[model samples]
Target: MSEGISVVRVTSADLPPLHGQRFDQAIAEGRHGEMRWLAEKADRRQSPKAIWPDAKSVLVCGLNYGPDSDPRATLGMGNTATISVYARNRDYHDVFKGALKRTGQWLASRYGAGVKVFVDTAPVLEKPLAQQAGLGWQGKHTNLVSRSFGSWLFLGEIFTTLDLPPDPPEFDHCGSCRRCLDACPTGAIDAPYRLDARRCISYLTIEHGGPIRRDLRPLMGNRIYGCDDCLAACPWNRFAKAGQELKLQARDDLRAPKLRELAGLDDPGFRALFSGSPIKRIGRDRFVRNVLIAIGNSGERGFLDVVATLLDDTAPVVRGAAVWALRRLAEPAQAAAERARRLPGEADATVRAEWTEAMD
Candidate 1:
């Protein structure tokens, strides 16, 4: 019998060690580019035993947070920001952690056993642990795809000293479907199951510090916070309905923020707007960086004034991206004249390069 949530139990010995090898190889090959933390914490992320020495059983839990509507529907709406559904409202790390604490406390009280909860914050290889516990298998997009909820599950884990019964591992069922791979605008999914985070729009937008690659910017469109293209392309998502988590549901404003409005946000204003949302983690400058990319891709001249003002923003990344956007919307000579005046005072090498490129 399955509750709305899927639970997986695994022993230390049954944990997925292969993830370590693959993660290591990816890090060594630079596939995990700019996210050096993955390599920094690789050892502990290998398994439950690595995180907790005395752990005998691991409980992997899946909470479905599917969106009410197709997030991809906003992709063509060039003038607005398209935030990833998971981040539109509240931060899941906070919401999920609260849920896990309550659940873990109940389990501890009932069994009188020692328990520890680990959400996305910990270096836990949750997807492998979830599959090992039989919640779902990793689809070709490298995300756990549930037959019930598709690609919209948020994973959490509990490591307990009690030796509990473990469920069988779920096997792969992606077959030959390459919809997710082909659907990536930046070709982040280079192969069936392999993901190059460097080329990933989500990584470039949210994680990577400083300016994004010049060549990849055009493919990013209006996706400001994170991308949901591959997840949206999953055929298994036909079963996904509206998410029920009050804290995780899409906020009306975040559903589609105008790029121009987002572009004009100062640091304090940005903080107030994204207060509890995960989008705030990227900070005002980075968030503005992402918005500038969307403004450039929007092919709309409405953002010219905002984008031009942002050329003088404190953050080099924001200034550089604004330069890119202005170049896209401004006339060649108009952009050149603005650059000729602004370039004299701009000190950041990256922003200077963007000005040079805009002139070209």
Candidate 2:
């Protein structure tokens, strides 16, 4: 007689595995945008066993990082830069990785040495896997939304060798609501559950390098880092509460930092401010470039002086963005004079071109 293990069957059908079929189609259509890594491991992302077949079941977990106050409430403070809630405190990758690692250790103790833990840094499709693990369903915006946690949770997973019971997949609750889609400033979310990260303000400012697109600059608002418009707009968030993780709580400094102060940061200053945070990965130039875009979109002429300061920045990309911001805030004659002053010192071909364009 075969040994019937105490295996809990979590129907993979309920979750509808992500990369196995739909994800492959999405990537094949070029919808993942500039995140080329998604295309790199196309095969592994399609199956949990493919990542580590050594085991039997998957254990998925969630941590709620929902804010006590409205994430958007501080935007009115014009001088302040609005960082996304997910980024306000210590990096979740570090936080969740520690927790999941401990959980994985415990599992390994119980099930032997065939367990692996993952947060967002793996080939496994976390959102889809979470859904399959009976956590929640992917919302219209393509983010997982839980009935208990609402849309305010961070997902982690454990791929174990033991055949433990699996949780039933949660059902979708989006139900024709387009609030997340409509709330997006850049229309990055083109359709239900489909996002083009290239145009997303969060992606462009943080993940993307080089110049900010002229057309998209005006829509960025004061968001200097990741965007929360889509996440915050969900009606299901009404039930969401403040997170239990103290490390994930909001930081007063990052709540709504002053645009002028942020624009003034040197490389060392930027490093110190975002040390334990995910924002450090973008580096100084890209971050300042983002700040310049925000200054341009602010429509506050008083910020022209701050923009002028970056004209001589070491980075051509930052200098170019500063030129664009100055032009946006300055009077025609003032802008022309500023361009003339910058034309001679602008050694970079790109900066020179931007200066000429501003003069024109």
Candidate 3:
């Protein structure tokens, strides 16, 4: 019973139907694909209180990270890889956590009790909590959509012992619009609010380890990192404004970098290029693997030399992707000659197998 603390008891009816039971089921069924962490704590992810018993109410907040220009405008440039809007600058998890922590500390100082800050790192189902906090409603893509920021906002939360009056939940305004579902290149969003991460381009390129599925590779286009087709296609974004935070603004180097240049990056080069950017987390091997796939899609034979250099790469993953790119770049005879040179020295069996297949 903290002084000046308002309280609003949420009825069971006010909670999301089944209380995120469907999300749990989706994870359990392997719909989350390579994101094993989500499935590891499936039960706790459904309820905020389950994460911390002392938590009486959850304070959810949103940070608008919308770009001033169209995020999709760079796609037509062909050679450049499109990094998702969220990853353009400092990682949102680090940026938003700092903001949430400051807000939580202030609330804790006033309330004098339990308080915790959570960004994407926690198991909390942030979208539902945001909706419950009256921040926004879950849109058709299952992402929280704010009237103020639309779907371009990043969500963070503060769990506290203080019994603050809960804001009424926002109503879903998606009404009859299926743009998000229709726009998904991989059909990741099966229905209005359901997303199968296995089919999601973002999940395949970023979250999933190892080589991407053969079928999904071409569909990825030049999006080497994450896909924003679903988010960009949303009509709600018309109301969204560019983020005021300096750290979240898009960098010019990343806007539309040439695919050939990206494919040519060595380990040191990759580190220097992506320093302080979220794309650095994927490392050079995976980054090159993605670039090679994009080179194959570019239909530009100019990148063949860049792809050829990676045939001798230390990492098998990169080599395999290079082999795949060579097959796409040249006629069978030329691809076969390139594959023959690497097949003898290839250390990884998987890469050797891919090279052998290319030579045949």
Candidate 4:
């Protein structure tokens, strides 16, 4: 059941030097964008020993969360929003952590080893560690690509005092293929194995808190939450099988959610709808902001009224996005009338700029 388990000895000085250099380079170059947390814990993320000096070996586990079908199928459905594959169901952090905690407890009882479990919550570089542990090589998209599981592995780790035998690292198998690079809607993957998060649709929708850049908004299409274009473009996925974990499977409601329905969600409704889902964390305001962006990209005139109603929404971010969406769908005369009516009373500087930008 645990065929994905692999070990790594943190005591080896040579193991982390290259990873550290690349990590530091990415941070120094600001490739991480607004995710300041990545820079905040640079030392701990690069070296496992920095997290726990007593930890001699790390147990890395990869769980398959492959989608049953192609996730990109929703992109053409302009009125329907496309959510990232991983977030279509339960929060992976919760599901993966539970399994890790149980394993940690068992290891403690059997081997008397102290254990610490990490599942995306901590600053540990799970990707580099996963690569070192022979889980898979980090593909051109910078995600772990397993020959058996493709790009659908969710990683978790148990830092323990047990000096377990290490598995050999997997070498890159990307070859000359550049499918993942060309598949980026926003060209976030500017180069092979290098990503600029500032232009990444995933970062723009999730990690970025404020209004998305005007230029990148249209390219986002209907991807309201995260993106999976690069991952879906990987040819290695042909060998991938559907994940057996029922809990991680896509919920029917989330599979192809309508933009109109998503745009109407208030804070309470948003919280209720996404209770166990990872999308709940972004909050109604940010989530709605993303939805409005999708609505704008949708270019469907039917949503003009829906976008107009949100122009009066309490959240400035939502109202700002509403202005953008309205402009995209409304006639020039209708959009001007809206600006004339709302601009005078608008109090927020950013929202006011959105109104002006919409006119442009």
Clashing pairs in 4: none
**Please, what is the whole-model Cα lDDT of each candidate in the order they appear?**
0.85, 0.80, 0.78, 0.88
Q: State candidate 4's TM-score.
A: 0.96
RMSD (Å) per prediction: 1.8, 4.7, 3.9, 2.0
The TM-scores, one per candidate, come to 0.96, 0.93, 0.92, 0.96
Regions of model 3 farther than 4 Å from truth: 1-17, 356-360
Model 3 TM-score (2 dp): 0.92
| Tens digits of per-residue lDDT for model 4, 115-183 | 999988788877888888888889999999988889989988888988877777788999999999999
TM-score of 2: 0.93
List the lowest-lDDT window of 10 residues for candidate 2: 1-10
- Backbone clashes in model 2, listed as residue pairs: 8-165, 55-161, 80-257, 81-257
State the lDDT of candidate 1 residue by residue for 106-219, as single tens digits. 779999878898788788777877887877888888899887789999998878888887777888988889999999999999988799999999899889988999999999
Q: lDDT tens string, model 2, 1-360? A: 001111112323122454478888878887776778888988787777778766577777788888888888865456678888999989988987787787778767865757777788788787787777777889988898877777888877777777766676777889989999999999999999888777898888777888877788888888889888898899998877778788888888888788999999999999999999999989999999988888887889989889888988889999999999988889999988887676887679988888887876
Which candidate should be chosen as best, given lDDT against the real structure? 4
